[model samples]
Target: MHIHTPACPCFIIPSSMLRKLAIQADGAERQRLLEQLERSAFLRGQRAASGLAAPGLLVAPGVRHRTVYDAHHGTRLPGKLVRTETAAPVTDTAVNEAFDGAGTTYDFYQQILKRNSIDGRGMGIDSSVHYSKRFNNAFWNGRQMVYGDGDGKLFTGFTHALDVIAHELTHGVTQYTVPGGGLVYDGQSGALNESMSDVFGAVVKQWHAKQTVRKADWLIGAGIMTPAVGKALRSMADPGNAKLTWSGDDQPGTMRGYVEGGDVHTNSGIPNHAFYLAAMKLGGHSWDKAAPIWYQALSLLHPDATFADAAQATVKAAELRHGAGSGEAAAVQGAWHEVGVV
Candidate 1:
């Protein structure tokens, strides 16, 4: 129950990953991991500072306001305003990436999903880059986006991958779009939250690339990880890689693989792969068929829904959108069955 507190920072780098990195490192690298752990604690404490705490869906027509700040390697948020929505590009790599990535994500939501912004009310998208020394992470923090430069060992710049940026901001969408101010960020519900971000993250990435389902790499955090980290953060097509290796490239694809407690990041692979299958089987652009079904499922799902609940929701979503016994609905059901969610 403590998982979804308004204060919980929905970190993209799972705590388990930090612990693993800390365990695998030695000497100076070990020291870097320790520093990350310390900084992460402080981030948890300040995550709720966003100031918008209303529950239930609030949709209003606002503007697509975006503000990017530079933490200047410090921990402060909305730090120094380096770029506004109309400002010319600065000479910094992180700033431009943050600004561009946020705009692309906003475009995906507005253009593809037909939602105004994070709140579907044109709520401004705010982001902070270069947070702390070798911070090694990025997150939604319940309000705005916060990014970190990796320790230069296991990962690269968080902004290097537009999917990573879209992934975090989608958390804000997940939090605000649900009843009771979003589902509890724990257990099955929390895993769904993670999967939803991955779902749209993949969608936005594909949409930006103009890639169809067959053409898309179907990997999350693809360019974010350094070549040293064994290739990307997670793979939706094959969960075996994630389950067999500590490097975390894939995840478990069945109900038996569910991480008992609330390991949202690790356990999210099941649903992630389910969506992947649905998209692949449906063929053509993911945003056209799979994304709409999943987006509709997000509204249909109960806040604390289990994997079974999600399977049924998406199946029902497919049936509703594509007809009761249409191929689309069957493919969705088949996708859930492949993941063992059925």
Candidate 2:
């Protein structure tokens, strides 16, 4: 699904009366409100963790599995399985696309990364298709990857693209490894996480298609958008210039125009640009060298890593894998400097 725009109101404000009440009151009232917000956030995290804590449905032992549901193509969430372990035949193109995308992601992890599943523990791969009628965004939801058949105007089914599927699944990998990592879904750290997912997402696609760096498009969600929509979600090669807007431009390529604090997806363009530059500078299939360095940086580094930290980590990985003054190390350093990551 394509969330061209944010699904929810994006922000919330406390009642004016409550704010005024707290301002007038002493310590206890303000503390109570603060505590409430903290508690609410904690509860939400707990609930998401609980959902992901167990395997949703085991279709097979390893990462390969398939199942389908009608989804009724409406605005209701998939609450429970209408039928379990029953194969709802791939009746349409959308279902087939989802199945293929899921299998591709599973294979990428198993063969390339050697990760059994999202958590590297042979966790079940679960997906719900035909979700909410006209639901525009596909999400991991901390458990299953849920797909939506688009409104048919701006987007088709999200499952059409393998990279998008892998992208969502990588979010699970981040959660397990960087649990409670202080990369608030905004600013540099948030951008790093977003870029990390894209890096792996594109790598999986490249590995699956056997495309080299010189041959890859380096664009995420290349096929998801319908002919009507003018652009893909975001471009790693060129961030701000990826789309032409009806109103005005959406992103700023450089750090000068970078919005320091925003949602992870929007602010991610900075680091994404850095990765693209790094891959191009390395001058080979992205998955061959650049991807491994980045993966090692992500899995081994601190959770609160910044762009500079990531740059250094890649340099370190290159030095260890190649040599201190190797071409890959120099390319990584140059790319970060080009993007102002240093």
Candidate 3:
């Protein structure tokens, strides 16, 4: 049996936001937004042809091989090498940010999760910064991370936020870790894929800042957007606050809020909040307990698992890790129920 997964680029900025910006802008700005929309469509077509985002390419083992490339404000990829694993910092901020962001993401998975790298194979982490002129998005292009300077209106630079980098890279992590090779990136499972990235993205930031559940803001892509777009792209702590700064969040905290098999990023708010609730109830560093349980649950998920199935899997994962019927297990169950997923 084969699942027709939406083999598409995982972008930090959702299409809806971009479309809105495009419709509202004028003159040169509108043209740039239209160009971005077209580029995104083109990328989706490429992914559909390629089958996998990160294709099966064997990488050297043992070394934390990392490289940063400069796109020079053009569309070309894997551009000029600007930094390496052992090089000095460059004058370009985007170059340094991509370099440092990839390194930090690698360290989090390596040190906290005990995973070697994106593939757990010590595979090299690479990134391309300043991709295309005023590109308004960042994404895991199936093989590498690409950043845009953002038009400075709706969005700012992409590399400044650790979680944004972590979120995109975690898509690579899922490409390697999910059961049956990967989850079909469509419908409910597609939403779950987005949610998983959000889960780890928030955890990475929390883990790095040494923030406990209460202290963590649970905001994704925070500080990447201009002050005009609100506080952040998404809020796990309160999904309804996802678009507080823009047109207001449409994310619902329950299955009733599901948008008719719509945008994965929007539908993800339910599960995002579920993870937040469980982590909050568990009351500790997200990485220490919540992340491990969610990670373990990732392996158990059916490739096409629905919201109910995922909720059940998390409950099972918690029970497996913290003993059956334990407080942790109850918390997982309670969290799902709170989010109306159970």
Best-performing candidate as measured by lDDT: 3
Model 2 TM-score relative to the real fold = 0.76
What is residue 71's positional error in candidate 1, in angstroms? 0.7
Candidate 2 residue lDDT tens string, 1-342: 211111111111112222333455467546544443443345345543443355554443353554544577643445445323245544577666666777787777776666677766666666677766564557665656677675565456688878888887776666555534323344566566667777788888888888877788777777665655545666677775635321122454557667755545655667777778888888677877888777666655555667777778778988887899998889888888887767
Go through the candidates in order and give each one's C-alpha lDDT. Answer: 0.80, 0.62, 0.84
- TM-score computed on alpha carbons, candidate 3: 0.94
How well is each residue in 1-342 modelled by candidate 1, as lDDT tens digits? 333333457777777778777887899888888888877777667655543444323334434577888998997776998888778899988889988998899888887788888877777778899998888899887777899998777878798788899889888887777655666667888888888898888889999999999988887887676666756677777765853233644357777776687468888999999999999999999999999898888787666777888889889999999899999999999999988888
What is the lDDT, from 0 to 100, of the residue 147 in candidate 3? 95
Model 3: how far residue 252 lies from native, Å: 1.4
Using all chains and alpha carbons, the TM-scores for the candidates as numbered come to 0.91, 0.76, 0.94
Worst 10 residues of 3 by lDDT: 53-62
> Higher-lDDT candidate among 2 and 3?
3
For the record, the alpha-carbon RMSD of candidate 2 to the native fold, in angstroms, is: 9.9
Better of 1 and 2 by lDDT: 1
RMSD of each: 3.2, 9.9, 1.9
